[model samples]
Target: MTTQTPPVLALDVGGTKLAAGILTADDMLQQRAEVPTLAQEGSAEAILGRLIGLARDVIAAAPERPRAVGVASAGQIDPRQGDVVFATDNLPGWTGLALGRRLAEALDLPVFVENDVNAFALAEAQLGAGRGYHHQVLLAVGTGVGGGIVVDGKLYSGSMGRGGEIGHVCIVPGGRPCTCGQIGCLESYAGMRVMLPASGYPSLRALADDYLAGKSIPAVDEAAHWLGHGLAQAAHVLGPEVLLVGGSIGLLGERFLADVRLSYAVAAIKSYRNIPIVPTQLGADSGLLGAGVYARQRSGD
Candidate 1:
């Protein structure tokens, strides 16, 4: 008789929200719950308390006790130590937090942490749009832009676990200032923080609504163009088999993706222009699922 593997608990910590779920032995996410992060409060303890509460809420609904916990967070993470090496102001007071150790102590379970975008890429590569592809890249365009890379069916987090930071890629030399204290980065142009204001809309949903309703928003087009340029640069460097676009902005649907593709065609070399680019299949749950899967793997469960 074979013993069953226990489910894994997963949490995703973003600047805007905190989410928790259970990845069942059958590989489905269950007992999902989320709440606004309210990061502007600038209290790491408060945020962590909320995360722990959310995790417990989900665990109460799980069919079986989870074997471990996995966290996906928005920052440059030291996966070995489960520490946040750096974070933008979006997640104030997040840097230097010993997230993994704290969570392990709080939950009394083994805990693993990874950059949220890297976790998203892991899910996409193993179970979502990047499935069946050994080499792929994922760009998540939302309040900020982030990226993850998978090589030979494994996530390739670079030295210090900051490899797939595609958002910081320079698309324009000395252009707009970015939140990361850099100039001319792809995120400065394509991220929602810039695009929303440039579009003269109060919110990203409003801008997306107008664009999807056939209103030709120049700001949207411009952001897409820059995003394409960033992708072109990635193509030139990594030459991945597929490119996956996720995050709220990336979900603006086919029309926006067409615009990005057009700009990519203009920027990429002829030989690299034909690589397939697609949207992420896992949608909002990618980070949660990825975190769970990563924990399961790391824990040898």
Candidate 2:
């Protein structure tokens, strides 16, 4: 009798980049490739065509043919129907896209679509920062802020599939507006887009440079404050055992981490006095890894 091969293939479709990889059961990538995402094409067909090209490249380099594919994209997805139901700020033409079915048809393999932040959280829970914890919260602060929750090692996508939207959590009641049409969302202030301007930088790497120059401390402090306020509210609701921070803002290191914790303590109710906050071990690749793992699990391989 012949033994069955393992399932592999993961793609991360981001606003700025598209990453594809072939993974093994051991949580390692067998092949990988990355390219820019030129989202100006303005339609799912165009974007997905580019993604399919990238996938083909990885498939060619893989040691063996992958049995399945998983995609982690920035948006709200209807898992039951495998549809991209809403647009995330990152990708412009993602709303109402039949991403799962389309990909499965094109690749001739099963495909899974998951929210990018949820994929990051799953990476943390199963292989990274939250590996040992059954319940954890992942906060991704980058071009925009996103969040994910893992309960008992399983992703809780909530009703409406927008439950982990921690970035949209109102902190200041009537402050800055978010792309999600909400005011006072934490993303309006703490996200990389917000911090870059405050730090007098034209880009994220420049902001990091400004921080190293010692002039961006105030900007960092401001980010931490907004993030803490939002997290305090999250603590009240999800109450995860650990809070794992990822994305561009997390690169701020110890200085911002301290302020985030301090502000959270003040904003949080008494019940969340001791929840641990830490950085994600999977870092930038968390989303990709999580997508692969989710696909493999769903495939039962």
Residues 1-301, candidate 2, lDDT per residue (tens digit)? 6564675899998888999998787678767889888887666677888899899888888878898898888878876556899875458778999889988988888998898889888888999989789988888988889999999888888875667888888887889877789898889889887777777767777666666566646777888888888888888898889998888776677767888999999999887969998888887788789999878767875
Clashes of each: 0, 0
The alpha-carbon root-mean-square deviation between model 1 and the true structure, to one decimal in Å, is 2.0
lDDT of 2 at 245: 85
lDDT of each residue in 97-181, candidate 1, tens digit only = 9999999988888999999999999999888999899999999998889999999877789888978889999899979998889
- In terms of lDDT, model 1 sits at 0.90
Deviation of model 2 at 292, angstroms: 0.6
Query: Estimated TM-score per prediction?
Result: 0.92, 0.91
How far in Å is the alpha carbon of 171 misplaced in model 1?
1.4
- In model 2, the Cα lDDT at residue 22 comes to 85
